[model samples]
Target: MKHLTLLVPDGQSKLSSIICTYKVFLKANAFWKNIHGSDRFSIQLAGISDEVEFYDGLFSVKPHVNISKIAKTDLIIMSALNNHDYPGSISRNKPITDWIVKQYKDGAAVATMCTGAFLLASSGLLDGKSCSTHWAAEGTFREMFPKVNLQTNLLITDENGIYTNGGAFSFLNLILYLVEKYYDRETAILCAKMFQIEMDRNSQSPFIMFTGQKQHGDEMVLQAQSYIENNLQEKIVMEQLADTFAIGRRNFDRRFIKATGNTPVEYVQRVRIEAAKKAFEATRKTINEVMYDVGYSDVKAFRDVFRKITGMSPIAYRDKYNKESAVA
Candidate 1:
């Protein structure tokens, strides 16, 4: 079993940080447990200070595990500190950066979550390395760390020994990647299943397309959204929807844009594709079964739509998820 050391912050919101850190720990533990029973991995918490209190009325800090031992651990994860109070600067603490750099030089894999990337960038550890953070913090991260390559599209980036994930819920992607690496793809799938979370495994993949944002001139748009949701498994034509909504085709198009931010066809496709994603992740159904359930009649058409929406074939999606489950 590999040892993971989590470096938690001290002060207000520390309780929230601890909660997030524990989630990460539980995810990793569950992932490996699915693979190798109960005795798989271990996590040790090394608090920066004795204990910290949160304004929201929460307190957290695991019992003392010496700071030096943390450095020796195989992996180190830096959780996000208080983003609101920290401002645009990388971090208020310079020694934290130095310690991280030293750990990297010593051959331990270092990682950070959300704005924790700021700490890594400030340490110069991510210099010239492609990294990402939550989209909300893109501008701040870019301006503060010019040397590091900022990649905002990915949920997580694994650069050799360094890994960084966007804040919020992107930590799942990081944990999934770790599961896949140490165990296998099946393990990752099992982890995702346990959490009831689903995401396209590929960063370049497009799991959804919104076509309706063209031009809105009516109430027909929201009606279109409702219609698509109701008829996801049926072949939907634009004229049919317009006639059913009791409006002219051109007029329906204009109203759909106004109500749903997408055109009728766009809305329909989005609904079908979204349903397909759910079916792919939740069921062991075959590709053809999924394709038909999502309303595509021809296997070829289903493949095309699946590829267009997810950047992967339907079979690939099923296989990938299954592989992750097995690995987990």
Candidate 2:
């Protein structure tokens, strides 16, 4: 049987990720027994301590085994944690990180759910590998782990043996993915039906709220960003921005990329896309109206950029998200 260790990290970990994953594996095993009269996975919750609680003591979890006791595991799962206290949470869970690194070096596959990618990235296993995480945490994640490629558009990423999923409750999709890999397609489908989870979801872009990246301390870059945000309807010129900031074009481009993680052109495009997203969500604007409102005059150009950034066309986005359409 494959040994699966569901790791409960120290500090405020998300209880639902731990419990839900454990329950799914249990159900998978039970289903396997019914068909083949054998268990496919031997699962256990392993933690630094025996007990952990969160959400002001409303929830508690006690691990089946201490992490130090498990010298080897076939797979290691890092459960999601509270992102607001992530630094402190990761610091307190240093032992878990060390253990994860050791296990991966020993040939075990590692998977992280939601913000658990933060913990997995900390273990150094995800260096130079693409991973996915909660969209809201994308800015902070990039600033913290610049070496690890953050695929914010993907719902799940499987690099060799390390797996990660996108934000919030979307971890269920990752679980279904793992089910298909370990068992068969029939079993995976059965588990999905049992849990009421939509399977085979591959992108998180449509769900992302593109708030502009503004965490960097570069005053000039911040000023440029503010200018772009305020003048979304106007034609933004990069050379004009450079001249307005009293900086050379090359220096402006370099600093903009370094500070915001996007070139000046890309930043302007994202800002415009965000505006169009809001207009679609809250107003009764036609696709072309929203497109023009965001400064894109060419129909094909606007549609392509909108679909590229959002994984859907403007009409589809409005159909899915527009409050007026929903009421109608």
Q: Against the hidden reference, what TM-scores do the models get?
A: 0.56, 0.97
lDDT score for candidate 2 against the true structure? 0.90
Candidate 1 residue 281 Cα shift, in angstroms, is 24
lDDT of model 1, residue 58? 53
Q: Report lDDT (CA) for all predictions.
A: 0.67, 0.90
The clash count of every prediction, one per candidate, is 21, 0
Which ranges in model 2 have alpha carbons more than 4 Å from their true place? Answer: 326-328
TM-score, model 2 to reference: 0.97
